[model samples]
Target: MRYCLGLDMPGDAALIAEYENWHTDIWPEVRKSILDSGIVNMEIYRLENRLFMIMEVGPDFSFDRKAAMDAANPAVQRWEELMWKYQVAIPGGKPGEKWRLMDRIFSLQEAL
Candidate 1:
């Protein structure tokens, strides 16, 4: 029910500043869209343009459909286009896959 993704920063300082400003308070509707999508917890962290997001959803969470719906929504699409100006994937990244899934090496919970 939890997922993580990372995004790199843009090379330009001015653009990076702009991006930070936007994130300081993202669009309200965007926030609503996410909350309505069955997400239980979500947060984003940044270390000099290297951004990481952690999201926890219900057992029925479906990123595939949610992603496609987001792509079709004009506001969301616009936001994504603008965001792309500040992010990119590393070499060997799969096509259409931006944030790579990280393996969980350790956890506090014990397997039943």
Candidate 2:
């Protein structure tokens, strides 16, 4: 399955740079956690302060399972805490929610 989500970064250019730098060499544990959670592929894009993520997951993936796994992994928790410094929940998102799932309004395959 594929999921697309949106988030926001602080408007500070320095902070955005730092966030990108961190992704350049993400910690092994953090990478492992993502793989173990059944995310087969992931990509993140930025447009000014707006951020978008595309994730392709295997059949074994579930948000609840991933959340439980992340909660149990101290390294993942630490990484999330560090990332929160640069990330902000999109408007209407719950407090502390970093990514908001986006609704797909149009798809070429569906349009056909």
Per-residue error for 85 in candidate 2, Å, reads 0.8
**What is the Cα-based lDDT of residue 38 in candidate 1?**
77
Residue 31 lDDT, candidate 2, scale 0-100: 97
Reference-based TM-score, model 2: 0.97
Q: Give the total clashing residue pairs for model 1.
A: 0
TM-score of each: 0.83, 0.97
Query: Which candidate number has the best TM-score?
Result: 2
lDDT (10s digit) by residue, model 2, range 3-102 = 9999999999999999999999999999999999999999999999999999999999998999999999999999999999999888898777889989
Error of 2 at 44 (Å): 0.2
lDDT of 2 at 69: 99
Q: Lowest summed-lDDT stretch of 10 residues in model 2?
A: 88-97
Model 2 clashing-pair count: 0
